[model samples]
Target: MSPTDLGPGGPATIGAAVAHHAAHIPDHPAIVCEGRTLTYQQLHRGANQAARALAAADARAGSRVAYLGVESEWYYELYVACARTGAVLVPINWRLTPPEIEHILRDSGAELLVASEDHLAALDGIRGDLPQLGAVVSLAGYESWRAGRDPADLPDTTDRQTPVVQLYTSGTTGLPKGVVLAQRSFFAVREALADAGLDWIDWQPDDVSLIGIPGFHVGGIWWASQGLVAGVTNVAMPFFDSSVAVGLIRGRGVTTMCVVPAMLRLILREPGVGKADFDQLRKVVYGGSPIASSLLTEAVEAMGASFAQIYGLTETGNTSICLPPADHQPGSPRLAAAGRPYPGFAAKIIDGDGGPVPPGTVGEVCLRTPARMLEYWGMPDATSATLVDGWIHTGDAGYLDEDGYLYICDRIKDMIIVAGEKIYPTEVENALIQHPAVAETAVVGVPDDRFGEAVHAFVALDPGAQATPRDLATFLKGRIATFKIPVRFTFLERIPRNPSGKILRRELRERFWTDRVRQVN
Candidate 1:
């Protein structure tokens, strides 16, 4: 088959799509991970067996099945199995703290958890708190567990609108909110592109996709799902390693991939990366953070591939806006744009009052798309506050050019995104405040060369309590994820606050963000 001929028109649901591809391209590679490849037929049979295993574990329709592991072929099998069994797949970020992990399990009411061996200890730490959890299956034994079950296909229990994935986004309330996405979120954009006869994001028959991002995040899962729905081979990285990624591209003949700016930087820094043969790489789609113009220029020259930038939140089903390759002109003023909305998607800048602003105006960016999340799982208040009238109120400050290209200038929300992981300042502060030496603390994002942003904290200590950055970091070790801990702690007499007692984070962030074109790195 010709490359573009395999673009779209697959089954709408993920499970059905896998089955369709297995029947048509049984011997074609479906996934490649850690030097092992699973053909479409193998993937299909594996998912069928996994689905039977899930049923044996008592997972039913709408039951949440959590997976706490890195990117692997097993993750996809379990993910597809959940889709077939009508169970919601709740992918837990293994990097999170035990308390945070416990909260997700308890909140999602996950009946079963599939954990990697490395994370079994962490799971045990919070196992007592998750009363709803009925079974724990180790990734090391996944094969044995599935081998005893039937490999026959399960009955279709899901539709286009059935919720299949639940991704958690950090909340300002010092907790995480589950962003529930339906099956349509995976297929809507592709169907739209097919119907419109537009090839905004190209797919191919022989395309090999490298998924370097973690499967726990929306970007990684969305990228992998796109490749699967299009019947392309996907290379899944268990964990991202710069040198390993460069090797995979050349060895696997990767045709297209997606990554964040931070990852792109590391991949470029690999020894002899520039001289490497990347002629097989057709396109590189990057997002989840901003990119510097200089780096973009360097990447273009080195990789010799078309580059596209996507922008959206988990609530918008990962990407509602896309900056196509056509506008990646060297020295073009549109290089800084976040890109226009995808076909069948609409975007607008809205004032605080929810009124639409004129073009070239900066305001909160709102998006309306069929790919939008069904709701923030079980949080009616949050769902209503963010998803209003079929629009997602993305708390990002950006404007549209006269040509309709979106330029993200700042973040209206106080959320700090390190690399691509969302770190809420309130969550960090809540952890730091537990230290006896800490009187008050405020967290903010600082410009980082490697990561797009790093967490920085302004601290006011108790009188004569005595503490250093190291002391605070040590205290926060088990209380929060290492990345969420502050990289720099500025001792302050007091954290500056307004008369109403709200923190003036913008004031503290000024020293780092001053003179930058955008407040966000």
Candidate 2:
């Protein structure tokens, strides 16, 4: 299809977006990765040729094409190529164990894998277990493969509902599940923002965005696709390093980036970070975990940029709730809130009975958005359980205020019941992180005969800082209720977190509940 055939609604599909930009602004830089820059024309032609390469490897529409590597231009090219061929791109987390990687490949029934040379070793022993895998291609040989095919666009048979990307869950609670997302997941929010004239997140003509989050996660793909669709320059780092990211932001003149809270914290702590020029950095969008109030203030002062907080999951197509720049005042009460929903998005709190709760009542947060995921791949029961009647039951436990602001207390499964009193781990963790001696902390419920279940905390102290358990408990006297104070404190060099930097409370709870009959009290 020609670029004009995409219609005036704007490039609503991934393939259409790439093709449209190529026809209109062919010379504009599309991606800059590892000292190499690819313009829109190059990205478009490269994706077209890569789509032909997929066909040569026997991949067809609906086939799963797996990719194992760090973020790069090749990964993005394959992302658009999957769109062109109506195939599904499965991005495997590079940090996963070999068994975990094998599980996703086997479960997805991927026909072909394109991995970087660095990761070929991980797949060596497991290739025999994957009977459906037809062929494997190294990133080093990608150019030769692309050069063998014709640089032409494929037929645009795919539509908005066609699945293009399948991202696995972080597997914090259990084994990772494939989250199938359609083309609509990437463009719906942009269309909604345009119709509402909201700049909660915007892509300017001169914007240069940094792809800091890895491609295996939803946040990374969501942010990167935005820059491509808007026809702007995107600078990608294969992996995140505070020092390298700081240098790129200053040296490359990166204007905006999307990162988790942990990444922002590390960036601020980089040695000699103050010497870098951040004048061109315009916006810093962060999410993934709750940011301590002090860190938020510190980031605001350090970056001197507009800050936006997005709240969502892999199942919600990345972001349904956004805390815009205007609400980021120094002492505003809404600073703690998760912000209102997008123009076409809706959120409501529901109690145990699955009925709507009154304002300010903590309950499960459900969302109705145009960008929600299609379903958990091959899991009908799970699809039904999570997505019911056009609403997504986000497992997050939060409340809505009178003004419609979302206040996320914690994950529902992470809530601890202390003598029948509900205690959200985030509240205790947030309070603990405020202490001068604490660098990071995670709280869980441990079996206790007296209280049925008592708050147990795992902490990582700041370097050279010392504080006894009693000192911390005393520090929490007025901040939280006496019952909410942690009964046992275990200090560690660092807390275990998943690749996305989310605390793995399940791991901590495993130690305490190993001999118990049930996980809960």
Candidate 3:
């Protein structure tokens, strides 16, 4: 769709952003996947074709469109097309099982399901059960479906407040909640930066970006939007793989990328990883969970790349706080902080009573930002509890330092209250990782007759390494407090993590707490 093609106002939402760039810089590279590169002009026209096909299939304003596929050019095109109409997108996690996928499809009441070949095979048995699902469109048939559609004009059904993407939460504690984000959610940061003229947040037209994270998370789709808004070239990865990422960085002149700590750890473990060139790589942003300082230090020295730490939740739409590259020094106090709030964003620590706490006082982290999500789909009570008076209660326990940098402690529900003492698992896990033999560890509080609740740990050791409960206990004695050390340690082949690299502590706690009525002491 061209600027003249738009009835009146030209390109207001994300779908409009594509048309905006296409009209201004029609030939610039927009997306690169496999061996194909799509220019802005091609992206705009393809999205228009997709919009027509979707509308023909009974999709219109307020329709729910679900996509089950790996990261690809078509996935993004559908996103832009949905913006052309008022359809909301629910990008399903490809790693989910049939039952899980069914739950999301039913919950969202999705009318159209667009999937790749592999996902189609996985859902062959369960697609019949989805009564609300109207038609399933495969990427193989996308071109055929849009062959006769005209790209000159499209339906105008977009508003800044209209929901765009419905991102499901990581669900570490329970079933995933769908976070509904409006068109303003993705572009507020960009709009704010444009007004402030911040050099650190600026994106250059020549800079190449790599989107290696999974599409199910806000980070993946939101990160891709930045490149489009800047009219830069983006290389989309099917998923994050160590060897594949290394090859892309060295082979494609990749400059910027987003990753979680687990991906960084895997990248560090790959054979001959040090020999790989990172000269072209500039900045790497990581979030989704707390990272160990050891891993952070090692990554800094190995890649020689600037690192930025982001802190946010799906409910917030995007990162409210960012620890920029300058604050990621070896022993800087700010290294442990989640960094200050971004421009045009405000963050504060508040008590349980909903009153603000003084700096250095621990409480809940609350944020007010333009990127905040509109609501959790069909979850009115949850939305009411989370969003209060334009402030989002993050549900994570933390404190703002004197300099306003937020230091995340732990999830308030995940914190262990043992004999009136509070213990955060990340603190204990960080100490355990300091041991040479320990590769990964998860700390939880178990029922104990003596102390009411005793710390217990599930550990995964380094390859060919051995360690006993006594070894880790002794190792952690001086590193952390004695009460925080694990009383019992069980070795595991590997720790379970979500696609976004968040540890599922609830799964681990289920087996131990099944017979009991409650989880905590």
Candidate 4:
């Protein structure tokens, strides 16, 4: 089928899409997790039964349901069930505090929560605070609940434009906002993949995809959706473990995998990763943050030409710009760029005034696409501010080349100016990560009397590796401009990160600038 034909034409709801694919590939392995395998037909039946159970509990069309759990096979089934029932699925981040969970539940107006036993304990701490929470269902008990239900009674297809999921953004500035994604957005992304050369990955019905990222994040959800849409097998890992991931890749002959920079660092740190026979591993798609060029170069040399870099936001359906397999070359300009904008997306770098900027001028990257989120749930003001004139202002400072390749500078908020010179944290962080002792690093601007803001580095040492504050300070002095070198250094066991492996710069700034009144721009 052509790329255009993939857009929201076949199925009105996600359940319908699953059913359609299940009929075509009934006996195909749909999901494999923790030694449990579910075929396409079995997966459909399981989801149908789960939908019936939700329906029996009064989860009708338009109801909002929050799912609190780690990534697992049941998460996929529950998501499918919610899609079938036309209920808005909210997958809570497992790492969130009880207060944070309560806030998300209240903000999303989630009437019901389906949580695993472990995650349910967190809710007990703030159950009294969630006024919108009506009922709690234990996923551990789902099998018992489904045992008495008939799968044949599942709800039929509904409107495709209806909200299928409400993915909460990692709110660095304030409260998290739910990005309401519709069925059409998923279909648009599936179509966009085709334009980005989906065949280059050689996806097949027999291929097994290793899903190591959290299901709540857009990256994880996108990988899961890709498997579902293509009728490929998914080898699910509850959470990312480098040794376990390597074993799965080599043992199961997994064809494709998705990860972030931090996870890739861990995988590369594994002793046997490079030596392992990854015969069937054909692609490693990565994004969520800037990867160091040194790491990318080493990965390409070790893993062959299977590394693809994607640049996108949660609001844009997890893929708007992709560096194709052919472009995974050492010292390639495209590696510095976020690659070209995906098909069906029109992207431009615009100044603060929202007008297009010169080719090399850094500006806020704005995108107009059918895959953009419908709106930020319950925050019309924020939604209006972000989505203007049919374009979504990405709040990212970047530039586009003459050939339309996007070069991300940094988050507009995270950009540092020292003595009137602009410094992107990513640039500084990339340089710091290249140090042998630096396992991870985050660069932020701290208060400075002379320069207005001085660069500060938070460094995490590699296992069995050590470095002193002055050691890193002197090391960076030689590699970067004198003005860009960090004035202060803080050593940590590990850098703070969200579930998707993106660094929490806001958290770092909060701790370092607590005494100051103004924190960020």
Cα lDDT of all candidates, in order?
Answer: 0.89, 0.85, 0.79, 0.76
Model 2 misplaced regions, further than 4 Å: 1-7, 170-173, 415-521
Candidate number of the best lDDT? 1
Estimate candidate 3's alpha-carbon lDDT, on a 0 to 1 scale.
0.79
Model 2 lDDT tens row, 326-425: 9999999888888989998999999999999999998999999999999999989888999999899987788999989998865666766554344678
For candidate 4, give the lDDT.
0.76
Q: With candidate 2 superimposed using the best TM-score fit, by how many Å does residue 416's alpha carbon deviate from the native? A: 13
Task: Estimate the Cα RMSD of every predicted model relative to the unseen true structure.
Answer: 1.4, 10.9, 11.0, 10.7
Q: By TM-score, how accurate is candidate 2?
A: 0.80
The backbone clash count of each candidate, in order, is 0, 0, 0, 0
lDDT tens digits by residue: candidate 4, 145-247: 7666776636566665888889987443435689998877766756566656664344665677988677888778877877776678888888778898888
TM per candidate:
0.98, 0.80, 0.78, 0.78
Cα misplacement distance, residue 31 of candidate 4 (Å): 1.1
Give lDDT tens digits, candidate 1, residues 1-521: 43234434557589988888887788889999998999888999999999988888999889999999888999999889988878999999988877888889999999999998888886676788778999899999989989967777777778988999999989989999999999889877777777887666779898999997888899999999998878899999888999999999999999999999989999999888764658799899999998988889989999999999999999998999988898899998889898998877999999989898999999999999999999998999999999999999999999998888899999898888888889999999999999999999999999998888999999999998999999999999989988899999899999999999999999999988887988987
Clashing residue pairs, candidate 1? none
Alpha carbon deviation, residue 484, candidate 4 (Å): 24
